[model samples]
Target chain A: MICGRTPDELIRDIEGFHGFVAPGLVIGAFMVDLAREHIGQNTEADAVVETRHCLPDAVQILTPCTVGNGWLKIADLDKFALTLYDRHTFAGFRVWLDLNKAKAHPNVYNWFMGLVSKKDLPKEILIPAIFDAGRDILSVKPVTVRAEFAKREKKSKIAVCPACNEAYAAAQGTPCLACQGKDYYHTGS
Target chain B: MICGRTPDELIRDIEGFHGFVAPGLVIGAFMVDLAREHIGQNTEADAVVETRHCLPDAVQILTPCTVGNGWLKIADLDKFALTLYDRHTFAGFRVWLDLNKAKAHPNVYNWFMGLVSKKDLPKEILIPAIFDAGRDILSVKPVTVRAEFAKREKKSKIAVCPACNEAYAAAQGTPCLACQGKDYYHTGS
Candidate 1:
């Protein structure tokens, strides 16, 4: 069994980071728990999150990784999924919120089935209920990522366009798109 | 001068897309105008917005590019800048908000100097003021991007972890970080 502080304590801490308690926060907490289980508490671990939502907050709060440090990468896949990778070893795990399995939990089922709409429901009741449901719905698995992605791209040549005076990556045979260029044509002149 | 619908009509439309009228929205509108000036209204043009704030909404409203179509790529540099790229020609323009010049406009200066905080400011005063300031502050320039970043990365090998049953990219000699990994170490064993 996954062990930690009480669910109430976790939710309270999560609430402090996130403005208010909601289903997403609960789900995020559960996801972090699973990630910690698989990866251990390695400060050097990096995170690749699929969506730009509550899950990233959970990762930032519960894990050692963060966006400021460039350890957390947002893939913006628009899915509620994340991958925790070890930079040195390249070992990682991808965790996804399995909607179907999530629905198996009573609270999640009600939320999905429309028994409880998000707007009308009180968070006090909803927060803990989602926490209970999260265990059944989350899927955690292992994988590896390319070394190239972990390494940040080197800065490319940047130039200012004389006409419009904006900065852009310098490229051969390409004129500034702003002042003198057609939509489909590649020739600079 | 940018010729288009009346300023009232434009502001009304912009207000509709963005929930509230603020300096960012006005800046976004001006940025869109600059983008349109450089690159004609071609449906194939894509946009790379540097920040995840109001500028994106402006690009989405005024230009042919959008996030849904996968044409709007967000660089998330956290700067008040944007780049509009023509997919066919690979030409682009970078636009930045010039705070010094923008402050030349009275309203913009007030907002920047913290005389007018965003929260309590009324839309009627705030909207037009920002539009005026944006005209003064925004700088348009030209640039070119490498072909590699323009083209999306091809789908790589994705594998499911046997231990936890989550999907991950397959890399040689790297175990799943979830099952076995330490913090901050670089080598995968």
Candidate 2:
């Protein structure tokens, strides 16, 4: 109905060319599927379908990083493997193994996500959150402490050297003699 | 004028209390500096700040995805260093390195950014496109060969099946049909 070829025919073709004929590369299969489905037939929802071209291997794609074995290497698609992308789409058929075969890798617990800077330049993108599997369970955060912050008991008023202790309250515009000493250094800039 | 204390005084106090004084650990000195300027002072803006708290040659806060003195090790920051979360006071510091390190480590990347099929979840976050200084480069993408759509320049078609000698049609997938049958793969797929 969609492309003159019924879903059965399409499935047969896929079984023959993609499943039976094609080698292990997902890109080509995905491209063919995309060209047929989205670009050709336009049967599926636009947002869910993605057609990626000239994409690097997962390990290669994640360059400037230090992990390995990023690809979903397999002899066939039956390997309920590969996350983050559609199973049938070649564009989504990504592998994460290290092409280098040396060092190794995960995402959630280890990765740093999108960047939002003050020095603006380009358009912004919507990025989802990530979490790795089996290896790490803790979450990455800013500066959290292991202990809770409890109120400190108040102490009697004492003078702290402005030269060494930046915490002390100082007189307005008054220079302390501690700062005048040879090794004196200012604490509260 | 601005909170009465000079920036220099604060810097000294920070240095004195760092490591030698605090001992257990705090964020890196540079990260602390960033936090002070971006978090400690800008209280009117974002509400929170946290960090993985890893430093160099000292107490290592080995959490999930921590960032350390990468710029210092790679090269000095000459007014421009890649900072991933220097602006987001709530997200924490070391975003630049944490993100890059995620590229290097997917378990952590996944732990922090992986998305899985679920209900009522916050949604998945596949963090492949990280910051390149600022640009969103897919650090996880693999090595790709640039292809041309408009022109067919190079030795265009792949060689025919070596065993069968049949002019391989585009229909047969990668690693030529001849090879697959004979256990020899081609680039077709």
Candidate 3:
């Protein structure tokens, strides 16, 4: 149960951010709710989102994390999952959509099971069904993150390109490949 | 110059997909142009994009690669950069935004410089100026990718949850975590 927002209010907030509300948003909200329960009041946490999907939005909404802020890292595993790790303790929790529990909602279950292959089902039918399924269709488990990954990455050295006079990662080698020539293939050769 | 579409037309297409036009799209287009010039009809190539930003859109538009098709990999280095890798040969090229060259355009230069300073500028003035800076602010380099990254990742084994009858990655544990219980924290314990 989300503390302050009703399901309709949550959907509206998600829609405000994502331009539309869908099953992923509802599922993400539930996962974030679980994460919040475990990670109580530690706002300095970082999120490692395993997919480039709706879950990141939930993390951003529920936590003080953002890609621009470098607190959110997208792992792009394409699994509907995410991990919230405390930078100080390196303790974290991984949350995933529970395919088993998803079966209780026929629309979501069929989609996950590949029984219904349609990509563009009407939102009117899909959104409500997914929101109703809610917390029942998720798994949250505690995990520990490696210390190196939990810490913020150091900024790389920036250098000016002689030809273009633009800053680039000096570690990649300079004269800057793009400024040396337009032919991309010949640069490494 | 982009071959078929005029600059206005290209911007329109980018705007249609991205909802707004900005400098990142222009840089992405130029990168795609360089990548296309090298790869040349090898539709089997994969794109390894270094950022989760505008470059993916350009790759999706100009090439056969896409996240859904598993041909586009987001490296998430958070630099405005990308690499196009040939799946068959492991040949690739990298492109990055040239921050120094971006300075030739006063508006863009000041913005980039101020960006590091953390001054909040309004978007209306910022977006068009960055767009105007365009193709001049990029660096392209050819390189070879390691064989391992070029190869497609193996699909993980799937198992059905006994409680809900839906499939999940069995390696994480059985009965599936969500089916075991609702308490996310204690599930691991």
Candidate 4:
């Protein structure tokens, strides 16, 4: 069971949290389970997810770490892996799917290698393959978070933006980021 | 209306998607509405969210850009701002709360300024303040996305990690990121 939930329970949670049951979410459950096992189950943890995909939802569902709480960080490195570390000590485990090991499971290997697109690879088959392979396809390792990452950032001084007069982190400098041109909306017709 | 949804509809969507109606999500609705209005309603777009907070959900709900689709880029600058740009030309708009404008609405100013913590700030008062102020509190500006950000990235060649035998982005080098030391799990006893 991942996150102390039965397969049925986990599926319901995923459907509710992610709006669907994704393959990455299933695999991520195993990855998270392995990491939590190596670390003490009850340890307060911070998570760094390596992709912007389904894995982030898995971490959010199974642990206290979440994007909103700032306990979870999305590195978006495009790797399907995650690290769960102690909040205070910065010690943790990095877990990822071992591609070589996956070779033993043809269905998983095909999906992981992207030899077949998800549309072509039937979910009925893929989901079972994922469950059959489970944690057998993962690799876990001990790691100490780098010093820079370990340091907790103090809240920045709030300043009024001269341009829009909005409050913003003063560290971003002058007139605020939107006014400085790192913005996304354009009102000029 | 935000995303063509009435306030009640938007709130229901927020509850379903985020499991709650966060104050930021409510404010984000107005921010997105103002951007979409300026950028044209039907334009194909990409988004860059400046925070990992409630604003990302607002963009996801209102626009086609989503974290899963590679269209929404989370810069996590910790600013409560977002930018929506044309997918092809990378020309777009940036929208942020105008702190000065918010000053006209006392409840919004207090909440935006964090003069009172959420625990002390009543949601009944805060929610109505956000709705009353709405698009009136936003500032929208034209922007051209930087060249580096505009370039569409090609899929990376996959390589085998020698240490864990996992398939990883070849550019990350030899043993893969986990073996290279930027890992989060600790399996060592």
Q: Whose DockQ is greatest here?
A: 4
Q: Considering chain A alone, what is the TM-score of candidate 2?
A: 0.16
Docking tier of model 4: it is acceptable
Clashes of 1: 13
lDDT digits (tens) for residues B133-171 of candidate 3? 656776776777666556666545556778755455566
For model 2, how does the per-residue alpha-carbon lDDT over B61-102 read when each residue is reduced to its tens digit?
A: 111111111111211111111122212222222212234443
Question: Could you give me the TM-score of model 4 versus the true structure?
Answer: 0.76
Q: Which stretches of candidate 2 lie over 4 Å from their true place?
A: A1-189, B1-121, B124-153, B157-165, B169-177, B180-189
Model 3 TM-score is: 0.54
User: Looking at model 3 chain B, which ten-residue stretch has the lowest summed lDDT?
Assistant: B180-189
Per-residue alpha-carbon lDDT of candidate 1 for residues A1-189, written as tens digits (9 for 90 to 100):
223657767767655545456466567777777877788774367877765556666665566554433466666344467778777777877777775586677666555334676676667666666866767888877767667666654434545556544444455224554345422222241
Q: Candidate 4: deviation at residue A149, Å?
A: 2.9
Model 4: lDDT of residue B26: 93
Q: Residue B122 deviation, candidate 2, in Å?
A: 3.3
Evaluate every candidate with DockQ and list the scores. Answer: 0.04, 0.02, 0.12, 0.29
Candidate numbers sorted by lDDT from highest down: 4, 3, 1, 2
lDDT of 2 at A134: 14
RMSD of each predicted structure: 12.7, 24.7, 9.1, 4.3
Q: Of the pair 3 and 4, which is ahead by DockQ? A: 4
Candidate 3 chain A: worst 10 consecutive residues by lDDT? A180-189
lDDT of 1: 0.61
| Residue-level error in angstroms, candidate 2, position A25 | 18
